[model samples]
Target: MGELDRAIADYDQIIELNPRGPSVYFYRGIVNARKDDHDRAVADYTQAMQLAHQDQRGSGDRKAQLQGQADDPAYASSADGQSIALASGDGIALRARGGAYAAKGDFDRAIADYDEAIRLNPRDKEAISARGNAYKTKGDFDRAIADYDQAAQLDARDARVYFHRARVYWQMASLAKSLTDLDQAIQLNPKNAYPVLWREIVARRSDQLSEAAKQLDATKWPAPIINLFLGTMTPEQVRSAADDADPVKKKGQVCEANFYVAERALQSGAKEEALKLFDLAAADCPKTFIEKQAADVELGLLRASR
Candidate 1:
């Protein structure tokens, strides 16, 4: 928080000097978002979007074009070489604001922003997939599926869209479709054990656990988890195995261990144990992890049932 605040102060200095420049506002918006002040982030992004649009009419400079043109200064600061302006139009600011709106639980505004982002760049698979996730969270499953479908068609090899779509399928109880999407995701990104875990889970839901077990690697970082599901390892062993020399990876592994164990407990009809493990998983897992999201969903469902 200190570092983010310092960055925000630096951005404030820049904005003070160049109040009309959209780039500074755009960067500042991102910093505000990192600080979890999503409403403030939205305001900054809105200003950036307005300035960027104004730049199109030659009121502003070339450095402030939407998503910072090909030579935009914003791209120069990126660690992953991806410009916030992912497309040719005003997609960057829209997507940024959309993300802020989503973080603020304003799904309607988020969806509207995403809609414009998609219109500006139909090939922006990331934005489409994001919109799909928004729709899924809004419980408009059909719209989510449609967006995922478009995203898949736009980029057939993107493993993430398949993985996300599979989760939607799981929620809708379309077990077979979920399994199919998870299988595709696993095949495309074999190193991602989450897809493998989810595939096995969906398979178990469909009573095809034996077939899913056939696909387990049995020799990897998550091998302990696979062995647990296979009944070859105990929960204590899974927890022990989750510990690692690297604290970061260890935290994620432990979280995964708890979540997977919770799944097993649920499968065995041990609702109380499942709830306990899921609570642990939800608290331990990073907010960004799908495991955390699933744990929260499971907790909600279980409590609602009671």
Candidate 2:
């Protein structure tokens, strides 16, 4: 906040001295961009580019570069001799434009600009990361993965790259890859809860019940959510598991009691009660077994009625 204020103050002074100066406006535009005022940033950048073009119209190197006759100064300090004074080698202008376009959801422009930035600086990991993120947002998982891969190769230690890659993998339904990337992200930044949540979802989807349960226990996950899974035990299975439990068993006894109630309801020809039990079984039973039990009960009822 303090930095932004200082930057704004500096921009104000520069703007006052050179009311039509592109460089001053460009500096201010950066501050607006940081604040997420993208519209104003775009306006400022446009104006800056125009002013730079006018400044460069007759200059030998700058004009030649604009005319495609020569290379633009890769590192020009003078805002006075070019339409845009952004460092050519670093592709700062292209990257900034790409980011601004992305902010506005103009992905085509963003990608084009990013392409230019990448061409200018093959090692611009920030541009690579931004482009990857843009592709992810556009639901182009393959492109996102490509960009993320390059970004990761450029800077393997960046946790954000791993996180974005995981998201792309998840979107592609590549569960193993998604989980692997998520685990890497977590290892790199354990404080981020996002990877943990994604990992939990993956665990559930994979039917790793014990692992999911342990994660829930270890992480202080909500009890109700855990119960949502456990509560799926069928009344019959609950009862059977409970009734045969040794005296040393605690939860099994309670499960058995619920099972008895469920079984009794089914025996009483209460279809709703039976279905409820089946639902509980679906939720609580092992993925390999519970699904069959639920399906069989449902199929039996359907066929009997027919």
Evaluated with lDDT, which candidate comes out highest?
1
lDDT of 1: 0.78
**Candidate 1 clash pair list:** 67-85
lDDT of 1 by residue, 1-306 (tens): 237777888989988888988878877787677566787889898897787667756533433454335564434332111235366456767777887787677879889988998887788877788788788877799999999999899889989889989998988889889989998997887766668778778777433443455565667778888778778899999999999976656888999999999999999999999999999998888554568778988999999988
- Per-prediction TM-score to the true structure, in the order listed: 0.73, 0.53
How close to the true structure is residue 254 of candidate 2, measured as C-alpha lDDT?
40
Tell me the deviation in Å of residue 235 in model 2: 30
Q: How close is candidate 2 to the true structure, as a TM-score?
A: 0.53
Off by over 4 Å in 2: 2-10, 19-23, 49-90, 204-306
> Best candidate, TM-score-wise?
1
Q: Any idea how many clashes model 1 has?
A: 1
